[model samples]
Target: MEKTWNNKAWFMVLPVLLLVAFSAVIPLMTVVNYSVQDTFGNNQFFWAGTEWFTEMLTSERFHSALGRNLFFSFIILLIEIPLGIVIALNMPRKGWGVPVCLVLMALPLLIPWNVVGTIWQVFGRVDIGLLGHTLERLGINYNYVQNPMHAWFTVIIMDVWHWTSLVVLLCYAGLVSIPDAFYQAAKIDGASRWAVFRYIQLPKMNRVLLIAVLLRFMDSFMIYTEPFVVTGGGPGNSTTFLSIDLVKMAVGQFDLGPAAAMSLIYFLIILLMSWVFYTVMTNYDAER
Candidate 1:
């Protein structure tokens, strides 16, 4: 017998669809409009075609910012993924330690993004901050406000401290889901700790690791607030990643056309890279 599908569910989804269109599609269309047109005062817009796109693609400023963004994301993923896994592995799987570890891990994540930035900003001051004062006493010349390298280091370390907890939670969930029989069998087989981790725990964690990697990558790539607050994209332009530069253009300089074009291009790069990551991981999962 043929079954009749329930079409009434679509009505429930129609409101959500409209909401998304209004929230996302409308704003995106506005950006697309600005990207292909030029406007001065009085709300008059002139068609500029692809001129902005070409300029954005060739500009050294754009290139440098893009490079910084890619480098930051790479470093974030490299540091956070492994660190999270290790922390998760060491966390207690049972007893009171479970709740304690979870609460501690969650504390950082609960803080506001701007607050995290502010905390790090004040926490790294040479005069009053513990880190800077200790480093100064140790004879290290660390001034993030004046030194480019120090600014980068401070931003990276701050980000790691703030976001690594997310990875730990994801990895911990994956670890806890593994059946006890797997560990019992490994023990019966006289498997070494390394063997158990390599063959069993690692494989079980792969799915969560992929999620962790993707989330961290996107956040790092799109990061604006924390680094901006800490470094102000400064000690020159050393910390000015794409998002920061784009904001400088759109809001600071009020260059609407080029900024809009750059925004679209920036968005496309993110989309393309995310697609590549998803595809490669999916294929690897299939192969395994």
Candidate 2:
């Protein structure tokens, strides 16, 4: 007997498709329209045909912002991934301490991004803020508002504080999902802690690690709110990543055409890099 499929399920999906079209697709099409055209006001638009794209591609400002974005993402991954794994590894597998640790780990993640930035922004000030006051008393010249390096440091630290919790949670979930039998067997084999981590835990957590890496990388690359709130892309544009730069162009400078083109390029770069990350990690997982 042949089975008949119900076509009604697509009707259920139609609302979602409509929502996506209204929210994402329409705005994207508008950006595309603006990207290839020039406007001098009064709704008058003329065909420019890739002029904005070419200008953005060859612009030094674009290169600098892209470099900062890449470097920031790299630093975030380097610090967060290993730090999260180590924290997860040390967390209690069972006990009253488990919930406490988990809640504490989650607290930072629960804070809104902009609030986190604001908190750090004030906290890093050299006058009334506890951290800044303490540093000043300790004879350290720390001021995020004035020094470029300090601004970068503050941004990096704020990001790590806010987002590392996410990585920790992901790693913790992966750790908790492993069967006790694996640990028991490793123990019976007299495996050292490093051996257990290397031969068992790391392999078990591969998928989650991949997830953590990708999420952290993308978030760091596209970081805007926190850094913007904290530094306002100041200290000589030292912390101006791509997202911040795009916003400066679109909103601050009102260069809509260039901004639209840059945004498309930004989207493609993220898509391509994410694909590369997924492919490489999945292939490695397969090989192992």
Among these predictions, the greatest lDDT belongs to 1
lDDT of 1: 0.94
Candidate with the greatest TM-score versus the true structure: 2
- Measured by TM-score, how close is model 1 to the native structure? 0.92
TM-score of 2: 0.93
lDDT agreement of model 2 with the native: 0.92
True lDDT of residue 109, candidate 2: 90
- Which digits, one per residue and each the tens of the lDDT, describe model 2 over residues 152-254? 9999889889988899999999999999999999999999999999999998898889889888988888899999999999888899989999999999988
Lowest lDDT 10-mer window, candidate 2? 37-46
| Per-model CA lDDT versus the true structure | 0.94, 0.92
lDDT of 1 by residue, 60-150 (tens): 9999999999999999888999999999999999999999999999999999989999999999999999999889999999899999999
- How far off is residue 265 in model 1, in Å? 0.9
